[model samples]
Target: MLTIKRVETVVSMHQQLEQVPGCGRDCLGNCCIPGAKLPLYTFGIKQTLGSNKRAHTSSDDHCVPGDVGDFNDYEADDSPQENYFLDELLLAQWEDRMVRGLFRYDVTACETKMLPGEYGFIAQLNEGRHLQKRPTEFRVDQVLQPFDPKKFNFTKVGQEEILFQFGPSEDNVSEFYEKAPVLSSPNVVAINVSPIEYGHVLLVPRVLDRLPQRIDQDSFLLALYMAAEANNPYFRLGYNSLGAFATINHLHFQAYYLAAPFPIERAPTTRVSYGRKKGGVKVYELSKFPVRGLVFEMCNSLEDLSVAVANACVYLQNNNIPYNVLITDRGSRVFVLPQCFAERQARGEVDQEILDTQVNPAVWEISGHIVLKQRKDYDLATEEYAWKLLAEVSLSAERFEEVKAECLKAAFEGPPSDSMAQPPALPNGGSYNLLEKEQAVLIKSNIHKANSMDGVVPNVGEVGVEG
Candidate 1:
């Protein structure tokens, strides 16, 4: 693996404020004005609210929009609102970090386009009684440490507009993104977005067309490889289907990069437990933090890896886990990792019945991780779920043929929307249309999924929810 140099990037708060592409800023100004409680990516990352006056203005020391940490207390904001008693905790963190020279201000990307009925969507956080148990720690999730932008040792990097500027244009990059929606074959373009704690980046197709539900192999993997290569690479990548946590109606992929090593679960665990299983070797442990142990027995080939994953999940399920599984080949052996389900239960915020009750295989459309709703910096369980979910729906030889058949069926079943694009390449070895694919993957950011899956759900028994 190539080593990525950890270089210090000096992004100034004032520069970020004035340098924001006038055209890129959404009409609602949700980017800087505060829309949710979570701080996606902060310029002055090392700083927080009420930290140092040198990093930021004393009066404007708090978050630009509003100090939104825990989302349950999310209130509608037209402009900056004077809040402290409720926001003090979160704001202080940002300010505190600012006092120290840890993190700083940097420009960010997010889904800013608001549809006809999109304004009040952030107001729909079901803090009330939901199926899944909400974590006690999550109670304060509505409030979190804010991002300070002053600490960034600003040294003009000079003329770097093209780096952040993405997406296809009808006029500007017409040559780069030529294929039109109607003119191109269906299922040719695909888009997916995710939002995690801190580490965040937007990955999308270059085309200006709709996003695809299922992509072919080469194109899918290429998309990941390409986006992973972006400057502000995400620590953890995420994808939300049309109505599944997808805040934006546009086609794109939102990645959570700040909170790398995934610090969501309480005492999040990353130890590779070793042991044995039926199919082959086993590496199973508690999913959501404070791990129990791991079991790695044996491994002969890729098939063994696949079987081991299945076996591990079966064991956890028999233990009444209803857990999440992440399977990957590690040194010629398949590694099966299990994240137990207790954090959600402890929080009294998880919906156990939603998976079985509201699951709609047909309309459920993009399967895998469909059950994912809320995400946090400490919830290792949520992190594991995303990893496993990606494996379940990713493009591969085993399921691409089956997925392709289903994508075709969905296409013929209904009229395509501008938001919908062409067939996506599977996860394995296919290629992406350099131009159109780019535009099709365009998206804002984590504000990506305020509440797109309010009533939608995924099939609990089965992971893949195809046509």
Candidate 2:
């Protein structure tokens, strides 16, 4: 096992190499040095907020011509009214929610174009870097400091104490309940504190405490339901896994309003029926997009959509793969990005040089925009550079194809019967009625006997003071 001391030593060695003369500037250190061993290629967030800021700013700075007027009008207001209503619904949820003051409602819609040289740069980088034969593994408990739920003291009633609580168990229901003002309990939609766009909101399960890392049928259905309800020509819904730019571990889906569609939304479908499952979801591969991912058109029936999403989540969870999910309201299409770079970083496999850039691509970045914190990074950022950053964090073409194939198979095959992982029980000791059929199959298949694993899924049944 890799110990903390060993990890620190390895980091120090890389830092020392960076200081060596003629070693910086993408030489990737020691790989070029005679008799030096080649280091593993890994990626990480050097500056978490830096990349996020860049993404947020890019939205405004690169607004499409038609959308520029909306941004200008928003920015022209000396003190824009915080109260925004979506139809008859008011954003009154933000009034008393925790972290309400930190929310940024004003959004600028900018469109970033891919540079001609982006493909070439990405190819060159991929050819230069040697892929690791195996990924490094570490225990979350060993790496992460114990979480203190109290660190976030926001005004939302009952939420101040449960903001960072480990799971969504019964004990935390009240606290987690207070985190977001309830929007629609039946559909489980709630207004999020952080607003990348004017109508940014979250869709969560009404009774499950499962985290985003392990999505179940109930959460998936709720997300689909909420997205469908919010469907319009100007709204998009998305999800980010625990390591894939998700600020919180809780299971939630985000929806935001866009004056104009993102590049991905408008991009023509390159390949339809890239992969499909009989009586299941059809996968489409978008052509010429900087990020590599698959898109699924929502099924006509809720049962089919639930099955497809459940199987997709099962495949991802079983492989320990992290991903980002996006649902377009206009097309009823869902985009899934199986992420490798972020997962590698979580496993302590990323290199120092990549981390130094502080570029982490979450849902926004994958959707065709990026955020850069430093002036140097922002100024240096081009279409080619942005694509290069994405390529560094994205799965290789061959691996992506393999993942796509497996996901298709899973959707049709209906999850492996031999797998021990079971759907999490609901909060009130009641199972999701919508998923009862799948749950019954698991029970008959004896999959529920498997012990709920930590990191893979939250153990909601057990309640103990973590610290």
Candidate 3:
């Protein structure tokens, strides 16, 4: 649980951190988002605090930190496709909860309590305070069109629209790309924003490595609550677990302007409550994480909003999911996504797994959906069959649990997959002689600060993550 002491420590740490100089050449301004479980998890590993502290930095880096018990889960190369390719590729899905990351984290209790002259680092965020109030309806004339996979063309936009690349430096690319026509775009604000999602919205921070997707928890929650109270239509906002959705890889949210009640919420689907979970939600108790909550449908005041935001935090603790949650009286929904994530979405189009079982590079992510990447093990002929097989396993509680159990076995650098038919051998056809290659060109082991740009773009015939 966060106390005055912990909050105070964090504030001091943040202040000290701000004093440091920027490292543009090697860093990206990736701000820590609110409620960063990974960093905290890393902290715990360093301190050897958790029951298991055995974690591996990479395949070779063993746990000197007493080996955080489950390192591979958060490791860089931890790909869901590599493990449960068939199940996920097979279209096996079930209803799950959603939580917006930083976008929703904009809300905080302190922010809601912000007075006219209550100036501070957080006070600066009150630029749009007046916008927040009793929820208002957004009436639009645009007809709604159901999302069709066919019409959904996920493609990249280059110089036409600025790309939010999380790179070391890209003066050449920036020189070629012109600012897009969007108002208040990040590229307009700064060139080095995050490349987390395909359709990234916010501008990358100028101070590389300073800002993280994880943010000030209280302030962010307050921001969301206030935003919800603004002249908008959405009733509730939500998020999903890491690695659960395609977007689970890089942290981001799908934002939409809430629309009027659909047919589902009306007659046959009168189950969902616009304001609250029906039956008072059983006070929604859980023992795993800490919680804070307040229901705001009763009062429309900021105080009520703050209290509600504070209370809603309990839901985070209760559910053990990092989130930015808020409830407005509106009976509509709202959607927000990365401003330039179109490029990211473009990669999702390759819906079918490749011969090697890589993910469809196009249309990678969207509300509650994940496009499993098909890679090496998934042969094209068997890719479809592979997807079907895995889908069945995921849908079945028993099989899903089994996969989960098996996944928990190997740490990032621990022994390879238990089910491995054979050891992951080096590429045949003399890919390279490791010893000779290293001798010819000096090589060192480092997870980060390595060939980031090289890794991001396609390498001579090598299909790149970004292309």
Top candidate on lDDT is 2
| Candidate lDDT (C-alpha), each | 0.25, 0.44, 0.21
Which of the two candidates, 1 or 3, achieves a greater lDDT against the reference? 1
Runs of candidate 1 with Cα error greater than 4 angstroms are: 1-196, 227-234, 263-432, 435-467
Better of 1 and 2 by lDDT: 2
- Per-residue lDDT tens digits for candidate 3, residues 268-317, read 11111232332222111111111111122222233333333333333222
Candidate closer to the true structure by TM-score (higher is better), 1 or 2 = 2
lDDT of 2 by residue, 172-254 (tens): 11111212222111223444533444445555453223332356665666555444332233456777765566555445677
Candidate 3 regions exceeding 4 Å error are 1-217, 225-299, 302-306, 318-467
For residues 1-467, could you state the per-residue lDDT of candidate 1 as single tens digits? Answer: 11112223322112233444332321112232222122211111111111111111112111112222322222223232221211222223322332332222211211111111211011111111123221122121111112122221111111121112222222321111111212121121111111112222334442223333222222233333322222111122333332222333233344432211111211122323233233443332223322222322233333343334333333332223222221111112111222222333345544544332222211011212222233321122233433332333223343333432332222223222332323445455434443444334432221242233232222212111111
Runs in model 2 deviating more than 4 A are 1-188, 207-212, 268-277, 343-354, 426-429, 434-467
TM-score, one value per model: 0.27, 0.56, 0.24
How displaced is residue 124 in candidate 2, in Å?
28
Best by TM-score: 2
Clashes of 2: 11
Question: Measured by TM-score, how close is model 3 to the native structure?
Answer: 0.24
Error of model 2, residue 275, in angstroms: 6.2
Q: Alpha-carbon error at 126 in model 1, in Å? A: 14
